[model samples]
Target: MGKKSRKNVFTPEQLLSSLMDNIPDHIYFKDAQSRFIRTNRAQARFLGLAKPEDAIGKTDHDFFAHADEALADEQNILRSGKPLVGKIERVRYGKGPIVSVSTTKAPITDSTGKAIGIVGITRDINDRMLEEERLKSAQEELENTVRTIDMELNIARNIQESMLPERLDQIDEVKVAALYIPCSTIGGDLYDVIQIDEDRIALLILDVMGHGIPAALIAAMAKVSFTKHIARGLKPRTVLREVNDELIAHLKNERFLTVFLGIVDKARKEFVFARASHPPALLLRKRRRTVVRLSGKGIFIGFAPRYKYEEERVPLESGDIILLYTDGLVECRNKGGVFYGLKRLERLLLKHRDAPVDELVKRIREAHVEFMGDVPPSDDIAVLIATLE
Candidate 1:
């Protein structure tokens, strides 16, 4: 080794000078009195100073005139006697907007390790902090919307539930089994049972030709009108007539209703059914162990200014069952987007025909699940399983 070179080993100041220039972060040294000692190129740029020399002896207050804020940070770092790391907000020297500065202030001690000064590194995290704030605001807005939707849906669900018959026990030699599942928080499909003079039982299944809150509103109105007209001893056809007029008057041109209304006479064991622009219903006869479908007639209610349907009668024998439903059952799609059509439903009905009302519901639900195979219900499903004992 050369004698002169060996004697001139690197000094602490030389090593620190090398470190300041090589570091990517904006690093600086401050005296015990909060004055700048040495700073890097990045630090100078961050402070909007043309050169490191311009910032070397200045304080944070000198660079940033936001007096109270700069003082608070200096006090915290000095009193803590430890590094204070956090986000500090400041309007950048010449930048258009306020910026978030992530800073770390470490204690630089002497030989005895007593604090002598501060060494700081800073970064501009304005973009990240702004993004976080935007996400927070969006999340809050979404939460607010969810809360409002929940409140509204809960009210609608309660109203729909109220419209349904209370005593699910049984009705006049017939046991009623029904299920209503909405694809969303609310649904457009509905059904109900009503007793007229203890002899005739009115069964109604209505699909409002659409989904969501709009359909629900129409279904609710139809329910109110049905109650009013049926109380006047109006037949199923007459009740539907009045309901159709009222719906056409209220609903928009694009909307209509497909419905099935029937009266089951306990004494006669007869079911007189009327339909309006709906799919066929299923009749499961325990005697034949077979399922039969009867298609509905006429256009959907609320379509034209006037519409009517003729009544059809079926002699309900012992163990005869009538299954009414919205087309949602057959129209339901799988993950592959293929529907579980009428044929599949008929076969499923045949397989579970003799199952009890509740069991039949379970079977139907299971079939729907298996058919859908991990897909969401494509639409609302409304089921009504009634049996003549």
Candidate 2:
């Protein structure tokens, strides 16, 4: 057999040199006097030296613009024989621009436990610092945007409240009471009591589909429609038809509203009302001690142009109470996901039938709040009660 080839084994110095050459961090050794004793390939490259030996015997002052600070830190490490870990600093390499770095420096000891030199490893952190600054800027921008939106919403709420009537007091023809609560800063609910000539008064309540700014804008349009028709002395059915047509003309999207319009003719002692996919109005009769639900056949407004609406007429008597409301009053949900249905509302009204109109409204509101418990309302609520004197 041919002579066996001798195995090649790397010496410890060769192994150590290879490890320093392969690592990406700048590695160097400094004597107790702060003069460079040795350097790795990465450190030599940073110092613009052709090889590691080229950095031998050089101090930081030979290459760094701010060497005094680094020299003082190295002196402290020598005196205490302690390590400085992950110290962030800025330094210029050769003629390059200043860059951020995280550096760790440890003291080296001899056989007698006396400190001989220091070993330092520095990792570049320029990209990490830039990313942190960008995130901070984005967070500040988001906060400013949220504050501006909140201020604008407050202004919108004030304007919407100003458009609604504060109190529906007892008038010459009929006594009226009402309550309105919006789920947010603004609502999509609107109501009005307009005098249609001397003998007739128009009672109107409308609910747009959604909440917030878009729905509030639609409610504003409904207000304009109601005011225009009532001033023209239009009948309930005719007013709904006209408003439906106007809304269809104004909207280009799928937005719609449910409306209940009633004309109270004091001279004839009659209540003529029309509904457009809205919840039925309730009439409480004191003489019979019963309730009558006023409902009619019609589609939602702004859905189909020229939609025909049917009008319902009910004869009025002394001590008669008419309640008109949005679906929110009846559709309120509790914590158990149960709705405060119309049946509960009817029972409450009958229980407080003899109470004054204002007192009756307050009692109903209280009952609703109690039924809801800790749950919040999911929609806007509005109600109007008219007592025929």
Candidate 3:
């Protein structure tokens, strides 16, 4: 037979003492009067005492800086015979600094289940609380920075919109209408109908390489330069050359613009325009009931400081319509990723050839919206329409 087995057992007092001494968290028991009846070594140390016995018979008010709230909570637990679990609080013991702790307290009951005392456990949560506070502060700072940026962008957008022509006057026999839409708060597309003299008006549209703050700044610079050059009575090709030179001088090679500058010579009944890597201008002839593209060859502005732009002349007849637009119009994609190409634009123009120039502008904008559906244009769009009546 095997040797008789021996069972290792501990008394109730020995088990309680072992658990109270070994656990790192503070543990304590209190009478209904909220006076401490017993405390663990951890609780005594937390209260700046040398041993657990030193905490016996003392109340939290005797050692804690803010103990009124704690005493009230303990009384509530005693009266209700309920437990308060995982309550996070900031507390100070003796003369120590305030620390965050998570505390749990439950009513102690006798054999008949009558409340007789309270038992509690507390764990330090200072580090976790500090980290959470730091994260909340950072989140507030980020939100404030975002609000500041959005406000500035809105102001910039207003300034940019103010730089565009508020009204396109019917200079002599040329009637002009324009529409502009930006994909963001600010855009890089610019257009203007500036009167050079009594018989001539310069119609210009340009698209910077990208959109947003950087592109918007370049667009503003281009608008100012273009207006200044046109004010000097420069022709279409000369305006393009001067604007190109101005941009190349001040800007790095990373930024460039596609420009279409045209001068409507009402006296000669002709439209002479220059292109800088821009889409061709479309002419809708009411007499022929057809649309044609006035093509020209030129490089984008800012490509070369001294590059010369070529110009083309199209004699205008009564009721002829001319459409100048940025690539955003042709490059706009639908949900299916199909481009609203130049062919479709030309067809739309033909369909609305007999409408007034302003009415025709409205029609084109409507068509674009219908084609896009819920899909937004990926770039800024600018359209300028002119009619000879």
Candidate 4:
């Protein structure tokens, strides 16, 4: 057998010294008086010391930025013999930037189980803390941006609603009732019942061809233009003709609207109306209990430069009801994609023919809600009910 050499074993102190020198984390031992008795190379480098021995015999109060707090924590662990595990600390040393550290401190016990000194290990967490702070700032900024947008939309909604006339009730010898519901914060539908003189009133209802902010803006422009024409004493057809020309001049990108303009002559007992590619107004006769659709051939406003609208005059008697609405009211869809058609609308009007204008509008709206169930409307719905009193 070959001669076997005796294997050398490292001494306990030598093994500990090797671990303290090689470990990446800062390691230190403090005496009972809180003086640094010994420290690893890593701890010395963290404190900007030339060598480990340079930190020996110095207390934490001499080097740490927040020394009083650090000393109090060390004293507590030494007196209670309780380990401080994973305590995060913020500190700066020797003019260096502030850093975050995860520190664990424990009592150094003698062989007899008596506490002698304090030993600690610290890991740098500056990079992780910095990243977390950045994320928190970004989240706060995003929330502020969302809040600002919500406020702007609310103001826009209020302005859009203000453009329509006040709730109609018995305007100029005619019983009037109306309802408006926008699918979003703003809508494209608009209506006005303007008293032109003591003997006549104009009822104008229009639907711009979309929803939201863009549609709302267009509707407002159309409302101003129509009001200007009315103030100029223009006829129903003349007013529509002027409005169509103005829209065609100003609007582009396929923007368009359908309009119905009607004038109720209380003295003449007649209703003269013009349609610009709009849904027909329903006429309910109380005596005959029959509904007649008042419709004519026309095109949508803002689509062409030169357009002519046909005006039709229907004789009106007391107790005759005229219902004007946007297509959203009749074309409302259910979950199964079925439309609340004109037939259903006419039947509802006949059912509530004798009811007051307000009650009639309410019941019809309720019937529509019941038909739709939980399905949301795809567009804005507006209705104007007029009874020749």
Which scores higher on TM-score, 2 or 3?
A: 3
Sort the predicted structures by lDDT, highest score first: 3, 4, 2, 1
Model 3 Cα lDDT, one tens digit per residue, 1-389: 23333233667798899999999899999999989999999999999999999988899889986688989999899888899999999998878899999999999999989888999999999999999999999999999999987887786677668768888857867899999877755667889999889999888999888655777788889999999999999878888898889889767788899989888888899999899988989999999998989778888888898888887898999999989999999999999899999999999999888899889889989999999999987887899999888
* Clashing residue pairs found in predicted model 2: none
Best by TM-score: 3
Per-residue CA lDDT of candidate 4, range 1-389, in tens?
Answer: 23332233567798899999999999999988889888999999998899999988898877877888878988898779899999988889878988999999999999987678999999998999889999999999999987876776676677678888875524557878888877744567999888777777788899988656677788899999998997676788888888988888777737899999888888999999989999999999988999999997678889877787788899999999999999999998999889999999999999999999989989988998999999887888889888898
RMSD of 4: 5.4
Model 1 scores worst on lDDT over the 10 consecutive residues at 87-96
Residues 325-372 of candidate 2: C-alpha lDDT, one tens digit per residue: 999999988999899999898898888889888899999899989999
TM-scores, each model vs. reference: 0.76, 0.81, 0.84, 0.72
Query: In model 2, which runs have C-alpha deviations exceeding 4 angstroms?
Result: 1-27, 33-35, 38-85, 89-100, 106-117
Reference-based lDDT, each prediction: 0.79, 0.86, 0.88, 0.86
Residue-level lDDT for 134 in candidate 4: 95
What value of lDDT does candidate 4 attain over all alpha carbons? 0.86
Worst 10 residues of 4 by lDDT: 1-10
| Candidate number with the higher lDDT (3 or 4) | 3
Tens-place lDDT per residue, model 1, 1-389, is 69888777988888888888877778988888888988998888778888898987788777665746755666666667767877575556655456787877788888977787888888788888889999999999999998987887877677666666666535667888888666765666888877776767778888877655576678889888887877776777777788888878798677888888887888888888888887788888778988877665767888876666677888888888788898888888788878889888778878877777778888888888888877777677888888888
